[model samples]
Target chain A: MVDVVKFSGEKEKFNPNKILKTLKRAGASREQSRRILKDVESSLKDGITTKEILDRVFSGLRETPGIAAKYDLKRALMALGPGGYTFEKYFAEVLKHYGYEVKINQLIKGKRIMQEVDVVAKKDSTYMVECKYYNYPGNYASTKEAMYTYARFLDTNSRMHNFDFPWLATNTKCSWSAIEYSKGVGLKITSWKYPAKESLQRLVEAKKLYPVTVLKTASKFVKQRLLDSGIIMINTLMEMDISELRRKANLSESELKKAILEARQISV
Target chain B: MVDVVKFSGEKEKFNPNKILKTLKRAGASREQSRRILKDVESSLKDGITTKEILDRVFSGLRETPGIAAKYDLKRALMALGPGGYTFEKYFAEVLKHYGYEVKINQLIKGKRIMQEVDVVAKKDSTYMVECKYYNYPGNYASTKEAMYTYARFLDTNSRMHNFDFPWLATNTKCSWSAIEYSKGVGLKITSWKYPAKESLQRLVEAKKLYPVTVLKTASKFVKQRLLDSGIIMINTLMEMDISELRRKANLSESELKKAILEARQISV
Candidate 1:
């Protein structure tokens, strides 16, 4: 097997044999090796991890023109491993393409929320999306429960506390029971897979219109302080008067002031 | 609300209203309070703790005639919260009804394996069972990976590691598909949800044929242990040397001898 320079920014050309060798060495049988190699070679680029290679293959399938095979997303999700489902990953990419600011794994009160959200867009409102890749009939039950939980979560949270528009998105079919249950309870349900082609086109178009951006910038010292303190949300910092933020985050007053100043600079 | 002396050898009788009042005061809603009262009144005996009352209520519903209409098990399970899925509670009842000695939270080498199933039952050879309940569908994938990883576990620590079928128990469910996936895997999958009812009844009835003579001569302590261990399978115990059994259980030599002798004394 050729020794590959993995993470350099160069656009390395795809090599089928190199990919096959890697898969085979990872304990693939001949058939699996060839299949994975063919899938990876079509989208392989420099600096991509094995995870990226796999994701790119699946994402390519999603992008294929006129190839919308309404396959069970839950089955696809199962292949992603346990607890590997993240609506945030796809939504973040979509939001990035649409020019919205994104923050991930933002910590508050010493607890790391799984993710901050899809976007903290214009108008000071955060659009948080709860994604469900429901496969089995029973999967909808928990997905509905999560929607209720996350909605309640944001209602009282300091950061997105009065944020408008909590979006609950699902990639596969929601059970009729769950749909009716949610509707009866006045919970919003967004289906990326429903209402046929036009509905999907609108979502895809929305992503294009809203490309996400990382707007957060701070001084080197302040950035390092925030990182060390584990407070990643800007609003969380905003909620704290600089002194309190410093005391609770274990940051000195000078460090807190520097971070606040840097954030203000970026906003200006 | 009539007081009836429960099975605890106490003078106090059980009161349904009292149990309802306790649950209500603990923040249970009126509906929850009513259900708890009905469960306690119908199934519980005198002097039972609140915890025991709840456990018995749920356990009784496990086989109550058409109890699904009366109480939805899934909703009940969800209400128990995450840790409620542990082997210490529900799964133990499932194992007990199937005539297996249940042990929970057994620490081995300073690591708790959650539950180590010693034996499911001796149908020619004793079978071990492992129970896992996922809080989310995403959890299913990693669990499948771990189940696959148990291939190494089976090869190393199998009781029949040296000679096959000296014992035959599964390391994990044989396939990712369903509880019945072990049909042709040379190992049977004895999951909580998929036991054959007739076979279970047969086993239970057969065990009942040998009434353990309530022998007063035996040490009460030893007798209790023997009963707890389900000494009906005395022939299988004879097949196992006492020291080897004790070593597998990590018991002291004296304890091993005492347990085996006590088991021997109680049968026939």
Candidate 2:
């Protein structure tokens, strides 16, 4: 059993490096620390946000007894400012992974702006997009303004350079009024839901776009099978006529019972 | 000169616990880290959030630069999640320093049901506020929905509780239609602006709230004279009357000239 009193750091002892270093000094191998740090750095390079890093660190620490003190970790993390930028950046990277050309720290018109626009795929001359990770339950007045500004900017800049369509994406369902407003103002709005289990299975069908390695192995089969069964169930329910099956089986009521017994006997 | 290259501790070689132990080793005295840790524990006698601990660590680190980069501080910090109770808790504390009571992880209703209100502050019985920190141009619609939800929440909650006023707050300024829409829905919207230098000077006048402290020593007459002059300047500005000085001096143009000449002669 871990010594709670000996292992517990102070309330503010959640410093990641400090905790890692302390563990190393207490007989944990330097190589192990290096391994964790490499994972962290790779996560960062893969565009994991600072907040996610904190989460991952805490998660890893929780796995080892006496490795993480409840209070100390929080204290160490509180030292950093609320890491909004890190979260936003990582969310953008996730979108970009799906064949989207991501633009960070972009400006529309003369106003400077930073928003995670998911996919900026060129559909013919127009940029078709699916926006994800949008803050849910907010008014689109500013989004409209951003669209108007972007549209105006695109019209001038793109025409001069001869570029085409610009698309807008959103995570939460768009507002009817906002959609109408965008239409009235000649701005295009597109929707893209998160990759749910069902969708993930569908996406995996075209495995070239997203390798199976990207998903967890154990749970992956479960979701895929569920999706497969759902489709089969729906198709049979909708298109397969029971009367046709009966006709194909060529069985009357008494004959059906005899046939079922024979079929069971054959299997036995 | 600051050695930027010397600061590079390859992430592949990072050990978080080593960093903690190093701070214990390099702090002002052998007991300094212990004392700070004790202070953190005492401060967190009540339940303390992860962010509060981080803030303390950063504060302690800021005061001691020798051990700053020794920890590979940045990488360790990335372990936290992006936005959740942790980030909201930190954001609330910062806002609280400026006199706000904020809530985190709550749903709001406006045109529709919206979840995830970052920060909500109450100024008075009548004022309800929502705070948002977005690095990029946010989807205004969602924010508007958040603000609307906040408004609606307050509208219902305030009426039920019989609160007098309600208002919404945001870091990003609301668009014209959002503001108008809010008005239509009877929601008062407000934006918080950080105090300017001039505002701080004005704050000095509220000396009862912020008392001046003496650092070393100054002559009594000099102190009295400085205070009197400051008061005079304030009064004069308040009344917007420089002419009052002429009356107080009781000097005509000729008399003032004669006095200046007499002073000059005495000096000579």
Candidate 3:
């Protein structure tokens, strides 16, 4: 056992089984999981940060883009931001996956003025989701954001008589006051680490509804091309014919083959 | 007569009387105002912007920094920003002048968190104001800001219970949605041009409650020194004897004399 430091600077006894669990969960065989865990444990140093340990896993599994890319859920979201996943589109698809009828950039007439809603989702009741995407992490969706979204919900619902509630969804954490005020006002909020049961990270992991860019085998250019071709979700890419995929995304045979293999590993 | 284009791009025939009104208001004699206006009209080209005409006035009256500085209220506010008139303090004084017993940066314990209310004021009812100051203009206080302020107002009001209502005071114009939402939520908002009768600009001009930095004769260095010494208002300078003011602000005899002259012009 080795003592390791966490990102929050807390020291913890390093658990080798944690690595094995992660590997196996990402589709590695039992033997392969043990082999990777052994490799990671051998190089692990006492007092190394958890982040460094995770980086070792990433390096150990670099050849396996599907598993490696999934290691950092937060980074994967940030990658989705700049690497052309179009956070709004990805969010809309996530809503769709969860059995919600979703529409993006809906223009609704309000009592005071016209309003543009980021994502309109409906299940038993209609929800107006305001997506706040920060390309970089460390930004908090503050009380201001929650209240603004709620106010818009009030304004829109008053005129259209459509939305039943307001949901503020951001790819970051929420300030304490934001959470408190949001709950107080009946506004639903989901972020990287709120609503413990179903945060943005949890939603993606629960369904493996990762964006195609999450496949590290897909270069920025290929990811953008795929996104441009309307193959946003990994499952969407999984359904494409290899020849059609190559032609549509302008991918070479090798690139297409590697992307498909990685997609399979994650999709499985 | 030359047509002058306004800041909003509207064309209007140049009216010498506007300049005359501004000069007379700022303490320039009518004869001096006409002398300056004659010079401005001679050089005035067809389709000159109102801003350029104002610049001409600034140049014409540059020797009289006190009166010249007061010519453009908006620009003077902007000057107070980078030139070092602490906006929160200035806002507090403005509130004080309006008969609100004001405190800057009042810390109140809220149900959620420790709230730092900017410019807490008490008149008939206690008003919690949040000051939004953009060093440069063109930034509008959006609906998000209004909503955020209101939420804080609600949270702070809950525990402290000392405050009766919320007020949003910004140095710039507000978005249409922001105004509508703020009013609908029962939040009092005063910005550059909200509340037609009692806007921020109107309040500042209603009384000659100009910040000391509005004295164009005071260099940025001089203005900063004066502010550091707690001489924020022009009236404060008026009340101080020459010897006491010099000792307090470390001003050279010439600098002190010029500042006092300009203060007298504006104050009288």
What's the TM-score of every candidate structure? Answer: 0.26, 0.24, 0.79
Error (Å) of candidate 3 at residue B260 is 3.3
Worst 10 residues of 3 chain A by lDDT: A76-85
Task: Give lDDT: candidate 2, residue A105.
Answer: 40
Model 2 DockQ (Cα-based): 0.01
The deviation in Å at residue B139 for candidate 2 is: 23
Task: Give all candidate RMSDs, comma-separated.
Answer: 20.6, 24.7, 5.4
Q: What is the DockQ of each candidate?
A: 0.03, 0.01, 0.34
Best by lDDT: 3
lDDT of 1 by residue, A132-218 (tens): 544332233333343343433343245534445555555445555445434433444555444444233245443221111111223
| Residue-level lDDT tens digits of model 1 in B98-175 | 565654433222011122333333333444433454332112222122222232123223333221221222211223
Question: Per-model C-alpha lDDT, please?
Answer: 0.39, 0.36, 0.79
For candidate 3, list the clashing residue pairs, or say none.
Answer: none
Tens digit per residue, CA lDDT, model 2, A65-157: 233322122222121113323223332343444555555444322112222333334323434232333332222233433243333333223
**What's the TM for chain B in candidate 1?**
0.33
* Winner on TM-score (1 vs 3): 3
lDDT per residue (tens digit) for residues B6-124 in model 2: 12221232223433564653333556666655555555533344445545655665554434322222221121123223323433444454575666555544222232445566554
